[model samples]
Target: MNHTIQNLEASFQDVKSENSVLKDKIYSLNSSFYQYNFTYSDSFQRQKQFDELQLLQQQQDYMIESMNHTFQNLEASFRDVQSANGVLNGRLDSLNSSFLQQNHSSVDYITKELQLQTQNLSLSLMELNKSRSEDIETLRNIIRSREQDVPKNITSVVNSLKLNDRYLSLSLLDLQNNISMIGTLLQEQQRIQSNQHKLLQMEIQNLTYSFNKSTILLSNLQTRQETTVAFTAGVCNIPGDNKVFSPGQTVIFRQIIYQVGGGYNPSSGIFTAPKTGLYVIFCTNVAEYHETFWTKIMINGSAKAGVMALLRSSNVYIYQSASNLVVHLLQMGDRVWIQVRSGNHLCSDSPETTFSVVMINGSF
Candidate 1:
């Protein structure tokens, strides 16, 4: 019984130690779980604050962009206002200049009229005063003569003198009325004269304006005549044998492109001037064989200018061209043409061989 009790005590001690170890492990696990939960909650709060800050920054960027757009719009509006102000200023200046011109003209006219009226009135007043003085002096002299010749009776003299005085007063009144009428007539005459002068100036202005219009129209007419009556014809590759031409013969141009004023004749190879004008004539000729080619520009069968070209033969047949040009003033119905002077084997098929005439100007 003593050995069994010792064994049971040892087993009980081992069981107690195992239970203590398990309790310690459970406490450590609880502490680790609490720490993890606190750390997770702190991290979530930090993330929420960061998201709010990013949203605020984006709103600020949008507001800055909107403000910049508004500033640009304001700038454009300012430029438009400045431009309109400048245009208005220009218009105002123009109007001011016109108004000043009209005002100056009106002032000048009024001043002239006033000066004329003043001069006329002064002369009229002086004449009226002189006449009145002369009439008074004549009346005084007549009265003295009559008094000397009157009877030496108080009653007769008083009665006759009263009648004479009354008649003299009436005549003076009539003279004053006549002077007033003359002044009125003078004023009317001045008004009529001013009106006539204004009419004359307006007519003169109209005449000047008409003259300017006529001058412009005349210039335009001359320009139109120059452009409308212009004639140009160029012919190339006249059909002919490779034969030498005489000096005065006409080079018949076969092709006719344009012949204004019906001046060119294909059959006779003549360009007749339809009107008196200046003409530009040109001719070109090419020689295919070894020969000296000569061409002439002529008017009325008279040579005005000439050209010559020499084509020398080599291993290959060499060809050359000759050209002549002349500008001359010709009368109406004058003939102008080109003729080969001394050439054989001329290149008639080539376009280089050409005759051209153009009337550059016209007279009357």
Candidate 2:
């Protein structure tokens, strides 16, 4: 009986030791599970952020491609317009040439006709004068030969001479009237030509204005298409374990996630505006527990926005984060940066302290 009781007590002691060991194993497993869960959560968050960034990039690419397609269409249209204008100009030049040729030919024909008419009139006048002189000589010879019948013959010859004189005066008056009519025709033709030249000048001025307007529009569109700006940077594993900055000190984000149009400089911790435009800026900062982090977004040495991360609790191994966003108009050559305001310490981990800037629209 004593031996059986001693065996039972030994068995009980062994069972207790085994139960304690199993409890320790369970606790260790639970702790490991918690650590793994935290790691998974952190990884998931990072992946989410990465995905968002990729999505943004893809959207930007799509927009750029669409803009390029639109620009191509515009260029094609402009080319067509230019081609049509050239055709119109060619037609106008041909018409103008035809008009000038017709006008010159008409003037030349009128001048030649007037000169020929004048020569004919002069020849007729000369023939008439020669006929009159011959008649007078014949009459005189008759008068001398018939001196006995002088009175009757003389009266008949005088009547004949007066009739010829009246006919000559009527012919001279007709020639003068013809000359006056030719002068009037020339004046009317000159006036018509002047009016046509004025009309052509006005048409040319209108076409020139339209062409200049189209050129300006195309230039503006091209400028808008060519301007593309976006960048994201972070402070990842900074050297020497010093992540603090004095007041008015700029925060340098050494890790470059992405950059487009080349405005952000990691070394200088500043972004120079490549073009005048409206820009959207985002900043995030992280600080350790029991500390405060203060930062501001600066443009040309002036603060545009600010954020604070205050973790005053007596908690160890914890962090607090703050973020700020600003939309501001920037001119080309303007400088932008993030500066420390009050508290100086910032986390050096990737994605925890980040700054990003993107151009929204260009100035008109």
Candidate 3:
């Protein structure tokens, strides 16, 4: 009986030792499972980030294509405007040339008419003087032949000669006055035409100046529009450590690192685009220990890119981080933000979570 009792006690000790070893093995297995869960969660986050980046690249390519199309349209419009301006200038020049030619031809015609009239007037005066001299010579030969009756005939002939001389003087004076009037009229006409030509030239100059000014203004406006397209912003950290967030809640990154061409509102956790352009956006977030969450980069409440951080193991508190990047074409006043798609808690350490945006190109 004593031997049996001792054997039973020995058996109990062996069982106790075995139980202790099994407990240790179970604890080790639990620890290994926890570690494996953490590692897998981290790896999954990284893979999601990579996938998001690829999606972002495709979006960027699409945006570039759209911008190229817009540029082409703008260029075509500009060329059309330039062509129209050239046509207008050519027409104006042709009109000016035509007007000048017409005026010059009119002046030449008037000058030729005046010259022919003056030649005819001089020839008529010479013929009248020769005929008067022949009549005087014939009258003198007749008077000598009739010398016996000279007293009565001489008185009448002298009176007739005096009357003829007065008429000739009056005709010559009238012709001179008519010639002077014609010359005065021609001078006045030329003056009027010259003044008209000057006025037309001035009007053309003014039109040219106005058109050039408009062109310059348009060019300056286009340049300013292109040069003023700039935007960049970066923010980091949540307000507190291990902050709980509900699905669809925006993640407010309160700390502003830098901002240029400002459009970000740190308090509201929203970024409004100030100009139409292609923009690159990135977000990185860490889920609190023992939490699984989905984070999304949202534009106007629509998801553009997303990342998931999942921790499946219970009693295993390991921080898991995920990141995503995207490129988007944004119109002015479009809003963007980061939101919790499905999450409970987020890591709120500085530099551990961040959001950033930058405009890569401006659209016309």
List TM-score per model, in order: 0.35, 0.37, 0.35
Estimate the lDDT of model 1.
0.61
Q: What is the alpha-carbon lDDT of model 2 when measured against the actual structure?
A: 0.68
Tens digits of per-residue lDDT for model 2 on 248-312? 88988878899888899989889999988999999998985567888999999999989888776
Clashing pairs in 2: none
True-vs-predicted CA distance for residue 158, candidate 2, Å: 99
By TM-score, the better pick of 2 and 3 is 2
* Arranged by lDDT, best first: 2, 3, 1
By lDDT, is 2 or 3 better? 2
lDDT of 2 at 74: 38
TM-score of 1: 0.35
Q: Pick the candidate with the highest TM-score.
A: 2
Clashes of each: 0, 0, 0
lDDT, candidate 1, 61-114, per-residue tens: 464454445335434543544554465456556656666778777767655765
C-alpha local distance difference test of each model: 0.61, 0.68, 0.64
lDDT of 3 at 165: 49
**lDDT, residue 110, candidate 1:** 55
